[model samples]
Target: MSSDLCGSRLFLALPDDILTIITSSFSPGDLCNLGLTCPGLDSFMSSHKVWLFQCDKLGLVPYTTLIEWRKGVFSYKALCRFLVNIQPMIGTWVHRNPELRHVVYVMPGFLSVVGCRIIPQEIGPLGLEDGPILWTPVFEILCNHVGSTSFFLHGKERGVDYVYPGLLKSVDRDCNVLLLEVEHRHQRGGGKLADLKNFTHEADNEVSSSQRIVGRKWTEKPFICLESDDRELLLEFVTSQVRDIVPDAANVLLFPRPRIDAVDSQQDFIVLHERRLLLLQMYERGNMNHDLKSDEGSPLNPTELGSSEISKSVDCTCNYPASQAAETKEFYSCKHWPYMYESLSAFYKFPIRAPKACDEEYAGLWGGTFGLPPSADKPGKPLFLIYISYEESEGKQQMIANKILDGKSRLSPFNGSTMFIVNIDEPSMTIFPWNTDQQSNPISVMQSFKGEGICYWSRHRYPSIEPGSLFVLENGLLVYLWEHAREVLTLKRLYLGELLKRGERLPSFPPVLNFAHLTS
Candidate 1:
């Protein structure tokens, strides 16, 4: 064990096969250091078997899939380099927004890793054990042939899907932040999106002469050509090009879409103009560290909706606070939509099973407390006891939410009824609470709702609503909310028997009866 024994020539004389077998258990860092110790060890470290072992140990993908993935990279070592860098991100991630049950499962994509959002929905009649979990794509970090990472965000605007491409920042081994910057091209010849700025004025002249923008003013357009006289023509020309790619360009521009005639034909061009301007903002943010507050206002005003008086509104400033503004003006801002954030839940200790079906990840007893919102200014914290399970109704699968204890009023336990139809392929679910006396037609308005239940799952945080809504966090905390109330329940999976042994129980239900039906 001492240096005397390590320095012995016999140690280095060990056969290559034996050395590889021993180093097989070594981590990537350990193997790299071992190779540095001597020329013999270095030669053995390069064996495909040694690197292959590391790749398998990473467990990011199947061994066979890793093998195929390696074919696209420089070598097994390079693949390991890529896998190791993104390894920390290969687990559960959460955000405290929309409903707390907005869970994002990071899993393997084609030579990349995707962050998918698990939309909260009803567990159909199939119960939790055999239902599907609806999910949507949020963001993806792909490894290039050279092993560098490129980030792409999936989103929809006006129902048109688009991928906002950007570069991933260097992730620290213990990274606690996920900062996604929109793609930009502030510098000359920067991003791919920025290059589209070169669309010629000749094209603009043809479009403007053929179909002049109907109601937009010249000042409202982005700064295009250097010459004031030529800027409008250049801007219109670029708009034509953008219309080809993004069909819905009304609000896709850096400024509001020009109130123009023949919009269908020129929609892409306008969107292209806006897209380029957004890239410029991204470029400015990246290079200058521009404050998000500085770029807060949208290009259009409330009254500018369809105004041909753009010149009149160009000099005006908005009265709204930057912090409270929506993200319509940001580059590739559609990624902020909640529903588009779902990803395939293939990578986790316990990923959600097929839609509507409950699995170990979320099927268990959970306990938590609910505190009234600060704005409520009312005193008193309430205990929220909920049991979520998969059950069958008639012949279809159903996800049921049973309220056992309402800390405020414990007398009424919710009579089990179908809350949401178990769906596995979407991020949000629509609640269909039937009339107590009728078989069809869910309650007309959510405000008049008396039964505490979830409605639709939105990608954005719905902080305005209260109890009965559910959200999940990345650290494995399940958040449930009540209607029109700020009080919340933060729950963690617990052994009901153990909790009962420790003296936890509902007022009316015995310990055995409390969580007894969870397994059924």
Candidate 2:
């Protein structure tokens, strides 16, 4: 036999248990590649629970755990704890080397474990306190990216780190809060008091330093003013590191904040240039003088006031009938209040057209047409309504009801009347008349049965009652009653047919045809 054929035969001959063991020995990538080879191998690859267990040991289990948790099958708490336990290790590494720490902390999967409990007992003493430590994965991940040294330096020098004290204070008051000052002090070799003074002097003397030096100074401070290049680099690092840990995390945090210095500077520069151009236009038009004259009777020089100010003044009064005649063509088209308001209202009104079916669907449903009437003092007939309960727990049901009721001015018209039943409950029957209008006498017999009802069927009670026994009534009558009556008539015809087949004949002498007796 050929060597390839021999190998294929050998592989095919191996037991599933043995194949699983061999596949488990391969890396995740290798196993993934092997899984694509053949149907038999794919089945073996999928069954490789031992390989998954190994992945868990290497901290890859959390992703699997996350998927399971999303499916509502398992708790993510343990995975969270695992992430939390590893956080300090990351912190320790970052603290030792500040430069690459930011790259490490914001790495994907770092903060994916937020809300996980860090058990001090399970993790060997890195001197963490003896309590359940819950870390915000996002903050910790961000903290990791901005290394301890950089964070301390920034907090002490620029006060930028103060934005997170509210978030980080609960975790470790000393480390995230007090340690900030301590680290700052250590970095400065002087107190926070001295650092503030130095920072103030540096800000006041902006002209004393070159742009390169000023940029470096900003970097030294907690608030790093990122250039376009720096923003790109930061995003690139965050994306790459997140992809390494968890590809999904990279997608979320890759966008830079719009309010950052580089972005704001560009926007501000454009606005400033626009304002400067307006000023130059006013100078060219010879309209920079103020309208200081108190009397309106005095002749007004049309070009004396700045075009911008004249536009503003005319816009303020252009709506009045008295000023309408005096207003220039520019004032009419300048788009002050009436024109702007109308334009905006029109724009909003045009875009926010009502849904086509809203009028037809809601017209009668509201305004008391389909709503429940007041309860009656006496019920003439009992009506049973069977509804299924979808909620797993009683507490959950109440919570859902409260949430539904919140901010709602009207109760659901169908509540307790329409029998919004679920299919999961036990097969059972309830009888109640719909008597919501509670009029002393119903307009019609069927109308009297409108709203008075009771729900009894629920999937929670299934198997106790036979499935077909449960029935629903609309307008207090069974929908299948006519069919049932037809079946009764058919039975009578069958009885008469059988008699005829048996050679039985009706008597000629005055015999009474008792249909009631025949039906019975």
Candidate 3:
């Protein structure tokens, strides 16, 4: 336990077999430090086998799969790079909008990442295990041999399914917002989509030809600067040239519910495994520019999509070297009608984060349900999901909770309406409704705020805010009391995926209704 034992020669003298076993047990960080101790260890630690062991320690992918993935990258180190970069995306993503539930689950595919949208519907009696989760292929982030990612959006149009390809310049590891928009680029030189700069929100927003995007834009399109030059050219070039579509068959299987650990999911995983490989091959045949056999020293640095595989149908005459291209940026726009939503959901920012025990981030996902009296129907009450965000209005710090998913069979609220707005500076004058909380425990209030409650009003289809007091309780519970109606809304910090998994399994809709069932 002391420094003498730490520097002892006995550990260094272990035979090669035992040494490797010991090294394999070390954490990736510790192993690197061990490697730096001596030149003999440096060479040994740099071996492919040692890196592979470190890769396996991550436990993201199985060992057998790592062997297969090794062929696609320059080295085990590069493969690890791809894995770490994408690990944030491999989970559930949801939106606060009621439009289509916006429940997208991301999972790994054959050297790619697949995004599947889970349709919202009442599950049938088959239950979760025997039942299926209805979903459609939303988008995919495919990997090049060198680990660069390409984006593809899936959608149906004119009675046909298609994949609209695009470029992913890069992804932020901690992105919090999800948005769908139209992006433009100069069509000169063989510049890849990564170097693009133009962006617009309007279906017909005009972009100035002189606008040059220097770096990534984190916010929505409105924040990006654009000059009003050629309006039609951006959208026109996107649809005609680089915006080539790939014919897609109706494939219900996009993701295997690997986390559920049920019989049906495991059984489908076998078929899904083989299905992914075949899909990868077909994509390669249809002009995907990846060299499976070549592990180039550098990653994917494309000259451009000009006249290459994606733009085969059009006669692209772009010949200038990427470095030698003209000064002015050429324009190509893509707000192609069909693939908007699919593309947006494909590059999911992240799922919700769990709230801490105390003084958690002001912005997080919170959920609640309408509490029923002892005799009321239990199953009738639906789980409601909302996102809590903080902002300053007129120099007053206000906490706003926006409703996402509601189970009630009532008219829906408008998009982006705050369920409650709390003035954090004002303390609540209203006393607690009951001495005990929802769990029959003693009431403990961390803080209280004067706010207004927003709920469904029977008089009209749309709901509005009413005066109320918000009580922040212990263990992340938020209680709101509507002053007029004297009704209470109880909520808590929630992770939707976890709640759904622990609850009952529900049946998916028929295949006809389930596939890409976007709300009209």
Candidate 4:
């Protein structure tokens, strides 16, 4: 029997380690077929070691982290499932708004993945690699033991750090977009359960005092907690205000606010309203999904149906005082207020176009100059260079226009830079203001503004007194126009180092604001 087994053509005849490496070479789609060949082969193929190797090959996370992450998950196979699904999100993502070149680097964070934005900064001498990437906390997806995820957004204001919690939506293996949306959680689970539990316990203890005041108005009634219907009504009211503030808004209904009717006094109402406003603005500033320029590569709108289903599970029935309930409602409402506006509830869909994949036509280094139109008294002003690339994030293909400072040009270098992420399929992109109190939807720059030059380019009309757009010309040259085309910069594709060499250098931000300092 031993001789027969030894002479047989059996895959198990090879050593385990060697067999595992060989199995790892097969595509994941082929693993099931290989496993079904025989019981012995199935057992061998299903081994954790083989899947562990597969996970390592993905290179999204380190082997040590994968090993540690394994302890929290069911098996190496499940761990591999998580890693592959999140691989597309591990690269660099940028936005055209904010004029700060906000670059989001999605990396491994503990048992989950984190998307950290390199704060808008001035370019430093070290350049991209050696320069310390000073990044601020943006959003993170915390994985559960079962590989499910929860989303949390980070915010800082007045020296205080706040975590705006939400949930993961439409996250599948092929999902291209990562939507951190405000969802009502019926079950207390994940990393944030403890903090919520503690808050609930504290609410219970404080309810006695506030109940005395609230009991007087509703002694006869049961005084039930605010229901989903109540919150929906309040959300409708808030959304109406949002529409009034920004007429022709496209995705204003993305935020689902909860009604905090527990406000017993005028002070509570003021405090809660103030808190709500601040949280909503912060979420509006951070939630960039609606403003994304591309969606052609996206599979489906996962949030389309899932948001209502999950929001239905939201139960604010904690046994807290009226004031506490109000505060809690405010808290939950704010979660969706800021970043929750993911176009999940958008009535109108933005235009789509065939993507220009990061090919040679328009996906490399570009240099230009910005000045008044040639017809203007001063046609040439500042020498500018831009880096154009095709990037994918949240399941969309974007034409990213990133501004770079030129040190070799005759003009002094600019202090700040701008990045514009445009959808390849659509002829338009949104332009956001640098600093403004108004919460405006992205202004479409789909229309072309023809200038006196030999080239023709498209520009958008902005509400601001001074409007600008990254105008791409019929020629190879790219232009940046500001102040209604009064200031324009024409750029031709060139090497960044050469442009910096021939360009005059200027002072940039401090180490923290510049890429000189790295954040842990």
Candidate 5:
């Protein structure tokens, strides 16, 4: 007995389970340090399950991040080295967790951390362990869920009219349209559109003046429709309006008033603006596209060129010296040529195809009975049109009719399957699920129905639809649904109801999460 006996006497040993409980209470850094102190401690610390348990208990799960870190400090050099060494591992992580992937935008000092508690423990090994363990990646994943933002409406000081009709029609079946209006309070003096334009230009000259003008002159900011302007101004206005409704309305839709000329030309500035904003928001949220480059700086060119000049060059060069010409032709006809060109084009041009307008008789109708061809014998699922209305009016009626037509034409149901028409309207808002049968008139089945202010309906029944259900309102603002029935209702009951009751309107339509939210 010597130094070993003395050290052993001073330390109190506990069972493994009890020791784990004690260690779990330590901070992440401390826990890591304790694991390094002795062989026995290191073995326990390296356990993947142990780390997972710690994540659940302490909420230290890893998420996507703009930069990777080591120890407790910010390290760009470490991040660069990590990216080079573990790129394949990172790719695997992203593939496994597709929802967490995003395009990371960051400044030098700014940091955003995303945490995930549900990670599997087989990816990588902690240093203390022999095999792979699920250690939090250097960067965290960001979670962007819906219902995180709010909306509100402000009316003219004289008196306010709740333009429910316009609001109902703003979001179509595809969830692509956003109609917003910008009101100029000082324009009460009858300033011309040209005058407003000049005012906007002058205001842009100085940042302080711009802030003052936006603060004082722009009153009653609401997310009514999308507008056309310089990209920066459009972004600024959108961000400003969103701040009024939800200070963290990071993702939003800014609708500008309709332009009659643009509408006639089939150049929907609103749709274009929405797509642009969507891409920008995606970039901001860290959903970046990967780019692959060749080792040599060779420019890729297509072999089957569209124009006669290019065709001639290829044909003429076909008979040149075998060695030099063969290499030249191979360079031009590389498979990567077309893909690279298309990638560049996508960056500059609008990618979404504009919806072709139906004739006046079938305007706004989607594909089914109204203007669509007849369905096949064994049809697939029928398209569902769920309409929510708070009050009855001529405008509301028109909106409903327009939605029905649009859904019918676009969906184009087949023989067996029928389009389900659900409406929430009248003294007692009720859900009427109507499906087309062999007989021309569709059968209507009444589900849970009650109350007056607003109604919700869908082809699929959900738990939220109940008799005498008290629809939750936020800030005195009515709820508007986007995309499918479930998400729309979920958002409404959870976020919009209180806003409506409080007499507020959303400054902007919250941005819709694309494929991830839809499929999930």
Candidate 6:
């Protein structure tokens, strides 16, 4: 026989188990390439047993978990596809404004990926990880039984939790921002569905060929600044679907905090799996029945569909309207609001990563409180989560401080309001406000810049920008002094994700409060 024929015969003669073992060493790319060489290798590569190994080897899930998950997916290959597709998005995600509230930790959920926001809190006597972390559902990217993924935004309206369904614009492999906005999809006339399928991509391609039909308008942006009443109504329309109640029993953490091994979290995966299935059902039923109302759950004229659908949608998902003409834009578009930027999409890209040890040094998340630094002898002040970013106005580089979260009162500076702005190029020649800090140590100044800070016309009254000095303390503290009021704001750089991981948990608010925080 010819050498090539002999080699083919030898390869085909190997036992299935041995051949599968040999093929296991090949990378997914190599295996795919090998499959194209011949019918036998193609058949060998497609084996369920082969992919079961691949799925386990992929490390997204354990072998035992993979076996259980295999029951839900189309195939092990599809499960692997899902795992590989979502791997990049499994880390942490955050936003600048609404400070402490915008830090969302994205992790694996049953058969989906869930984004959970860490609630602002103080450490309890229980100490760190010993305390349960308080979190509320933000959004979930769920996979259907057929392995198709769906995006659902959770909120509450008038004491009821609801899920808003929308199409994914894109899941950037290196996406830094997670935005919620309405996409105006204008499908083309006479475009064949077959043409759409032809362009069907692998998983995580939220904008599909069906979405990108011939002659279709390409408006793949969501960071829109909503200001007018019509804009809020338009945003409301995006999230106004599928009313349901979130169960109290479902108020468990993404991973149980009490256990070090995450044993409980893994076991609860089945619960999340069921919850995911229920959310998918509610989404399907809501899509089928536009006027989906349930009294037991969401408000706005409730009806009786299935008794348990709403609670299952988000475990404890609180459904609320995504409307706040002013803050509505903040939730999706992260631009310095009220001021219309040249490009709605371009402005949302803040925290452009300026260098350290310079005027641009004061960039990123910070934790601050009014008054002197904390003393064990005295209780600490309310934690203010601040987002510091840089921008250029007219000609000079300016640093903007926007408060995204206020542990004290939501109305003080308003969510997404700029707390201060400093001209990076202009250093203040003024003397330090205090020669001593809280500890009475000589306050060494690293750098100082002239700036403007938010000071109310009266305590908790009208806000006004007052002359201030932004000080970079030698000890790595940022203290802003409003010269007119003689007010001092002290801040320390924060590692929020670490805090969330170590923070304690509290009882979740009802769906309306948990999801949207629009309730008392």
The estimated TM-scores of all candidates read 0.40, 0.21, 0.53, 0.40, 0.21, 0.54
For model 4, residues 238-296, the per-residue Cα lDDT tens digits are: 12111111112211111111233444333433443343333344333534222112134
Q: Summing lDDT over every window of 10 consecutive residues in candidate 4, give the lowest-scoring window.
A: 321-330
- Rank the models by lDDT, top first: 6, 3, 4, 1, 5, 2
Better of 1 and 5 by TM-score: 1
**TM-score of model 1 vs. true structure:** 0.40
* Cand. 1 Cα-lDDT: 0.39
- Residue 357 lDDT (model 6): 81
Q: List model 5 lDDT by residue over 72-162, tens digit each.
A: 1223222232222211111110111123221111101111121111112111221111221111111121211210111122111112111
Model 3 C-alpha lDDT per residue in residues 1-520, reported as the tens digit of each score: 5565444355756576777787877766676787788776776766787778777877766797687667665777666656766665666555433445555666676566766555443333442223343456666766665656555555543344545455444455554333332344435552543232222222223322222211122112432232222112222233222223342322544444446456775565565555555454554554443222212321211212221232221221221100100011122211110122322212223324444454336567665654521101123345455667666889988777766455555426642346788888899998766677434668777888899877675664667668999887775677777777666666766543333333333233221122223232
Per-residue lDDT of model 6, residues 333-395, tens digit only: 443433323212111223334347865567777766666442111233456667788888899
Stretches > 4 Å off in candidate 5: 1-12, 22-30, 33-44, 55-449, 453-520
Q: After superposition, how far is residue 45 of candidate 3 from its true place, in Å?
A: 4.6
Q: Which candidate wins on lDDT?
A: 6
- Give lDDT per model, in order: 0.39, 0.23, 0.49, 0.40, 0.24, 0.55
Task: Give candidate 4's whole-model lDDT.
Answer: 0.40
- Tens digits of per-residue lDDT, candidate 2, 273-321, equal 3432333233233222323232333222222222222222221111100
Residues 435-512, candidate 1: write the lDDT tens digits: 221223232322211223443333435312223544444445554445443334445454322222222111111111
Q: Rank the candidates by TM-score, best first.
A: 6, 3, 4, 1, 2, 5
Worst 10 residues of 3 by lDDT: 319-328
